[model samples]
Target: MTFEQLSDMIAVVENDTFLEAAETLNISQSTLSKKIIKLERELNVKLFDRSKRKASLTEAGRIFYEEACRLNQDYFEMLTRLKPYQGNRRQRLCIGTLPILTQYNLTARLKLFTEQNTWIDFSFEETEEAQLLVGLRQKKYDYIIARENLFSKLGCVSVPLAEDELMAVLPENHRLCSCSSVKLTDLYDEKFILMNAYTSIHQLCIQILKDAGITPEIVRTGRVESIISGVAVGEGISLLAKSNFRIFQAGQVKVVPLDPPTKLSVVLAKLAGTAQTDAMRIFADYMCNGCEV
Candidate 1:
């Protein structure tokens, strides 16, 4: 039985009548009777003799009441012992971002962050931009790094981090690989390897390709690793943000700028109107200055 029901049963045992127990528990007498009846159904035995002028407990009811009392005491004791650990949990902060953003530079910066903030614990989640916003709203993450407008539909806040231009990642042996840069039309008729729909880049790149007056052929859609792999093996050439260049390995893939560069604004997002703890504010300040570093 639930702890609530167990406690309610105990209240009944301590009082002289159902009316008295209901008053003590601050619940209606009807609700109290129903709870006891439910308890009896589960036990398949009578807990109260209804025919009595005053409510009286059966033999099984007396034994169950005593056990319930002991259980209630133990539950409170467990919470008392765990109180310290709960405080420790509150001292931790979680950050979430896309796998692409965690490339060489940001990864090194994160390592330094943890080293400097030794007093606190940190957790990280790498996922698409869509889930990052959801995590922020659900309080699954204390902070998120993603496209600026991703949180527009949400009531959360975001500090602009950096404006990164979109670039193309092509196979080393591709005809356009030798070019200094590529235009939307340059990639015409070329099969594209793209990230899943949850990623802002997926929609951004598609629209850009279509605006260049070509029907984009999406050969595949998946994680950043899969997109990079597709480009490396000549499966298809794909476009990604310049800041994410570190996620691609050299020799296998060549990163070239787009002729008409398109910039995407990155931001650090959090609950808009919430009070920030000292640790959270300090961490957010560091993230806001990402472009300076």
Candidate 2:
């Protein structure tokens, strides 16, 4: 009911152990347990699944936790808006992105927009795509930049930014490296170390392999940077956006084209059917039309 209880419940979910969560909250285990029991009694729903050694959230608990997070986000935004009314503090826009998106020269590209609109203060968070969507829906961010194909159903207005050319990364000494370029079929039998499935590019690459009637022997999963590191060490091969070649050091890895290459469009998105702030509108216009605000 109270933010304190909601926060404690979230901490329980985060720390995985009730005792650890209690420690994190600087409360005794008995007090933490009492707070949770009171919350469940008020809500009339079981919150945690205690059967497992490590405490985990029940279905209803997950939903409640998300709402609790949204409540906190909205509260902070309200305080931020109120500050400008009380003082000379400037309102700023918050943007979220997948960490690897930074490899695409996003900082330099954003610099132009910042130069023209010096008054528009900006902050950025690098997180996973799913977390970005959750934050976007809760209005934690004015907009987020991510792969275009992943967010169509979030009820957000998406504007395509640029197409990312997909490429295969291989160890410098890999047999596939002998060829000028490799085909998807060529990798059919190879041990694949791929990007985490949370990435749109990962889903696209998986489908590509599936469509070709080729099932890559997946050895592991990781972020783009981690996947690249694995490939460089001959741990396995991976597919990623071409923009990363220059950004990531490739001392022991080789970037090669897929015979039937593919591309994923990066997009900027804002919650649909909502009034856009002046800052948000200017950013949308600049990214989509290249027109000065």
Candidate 3:
């Protein structure tokens, strides 16, 4: 029989009566009697003599009770020996985000949160917007930080964090690099080095140019850093988020503000209708309350 059934049998034998045993086990007398009866049926042996004024154990019950007591003691002893192995392990949260994450002070804020809440461990994936969406959809990430416009139609629960601006990046020696700001029309004749078409920045750049009725001559498409590197070597000009400019140490690349200032909204999002753990809920609230980073 089950360990619970065996324990209940032992309780009935040690207690003064069925009523006393039920009280000790915090179960009804009827329920306890039914369990013992079921156990007797399973073993095809009577555990108690109901004919007596007080319930007494049968010969078979005496043997079973002795074995149950020994087994119960061994079970507890095994648990005691294994308790040390179940040490204080922290719960982990997996987060995916765009490569521009460091541009904001989110990492510093996360460090502060982690310091105060030592029970949580964080795992981060800093990749492109396309990969972030894929990881989020596949449930490989607990949460994701990405562009709001790209994920708006995904029907996810999103918390808009901050506004970002688009800027044009050109080689330092390029003729247009000296301008205070550049318009999409001004770059009409220049070869464009763009990030992958699937990225939010790439999509936004193309849309902004189309709205201005300018078709760019795209020379290449790759990751953000690769696009920037290509621009630095005078390969072509590329557009990137304003915050991303500060982190790139390439002095050969000149970052100029976009004319008319195209702005983007960044958001922290999670799939809708999905269950969140206690830590996830707490972290989401913390981010929502002070989400400037």
TM-score for all models, in order of appearance: 0.59, 0.62, 0.62
Top model by lDDT, which number?
Answer: 3
**Predicted candidate 1: what Cα RMSD to the true structure?**
17.8
The digit string of per-residue lDDT tens for model 1 on 184-249 reads 898887898887876678888877777888888888888767788888888998887776665545
User: Candidate 2's error at 40, in angstroms?
Assistant: 69
For lDDT, candidate 2 versus 3, the one ahead is 3
- TM-score computed on alpha carbons, candidate 1: 0.59
TM-score of 3: 0.62
How many residue pairs of model 1 clash at the backbone?
0
Rank by lDDT, highest first.
3, 2, 1
- Cα lDDT tens digits for candidate 2, 206-260: 8899998988788999876788889888888888888777677777888998887
Mind giving the per-residue lDDT tens digits that candidate 3 earns over 1-293? Answer: 78999899999999998899999899999999999999999999988888988878889999999999999978865754453455564567888887666777688777776766566777778987777888888999898987787786777998877778888998999888789998888888888988788877788788888898888889989977788889888999988887776676656899998888988888888999888875677678777777764
Better of 1 and 2 by TM-score: 2
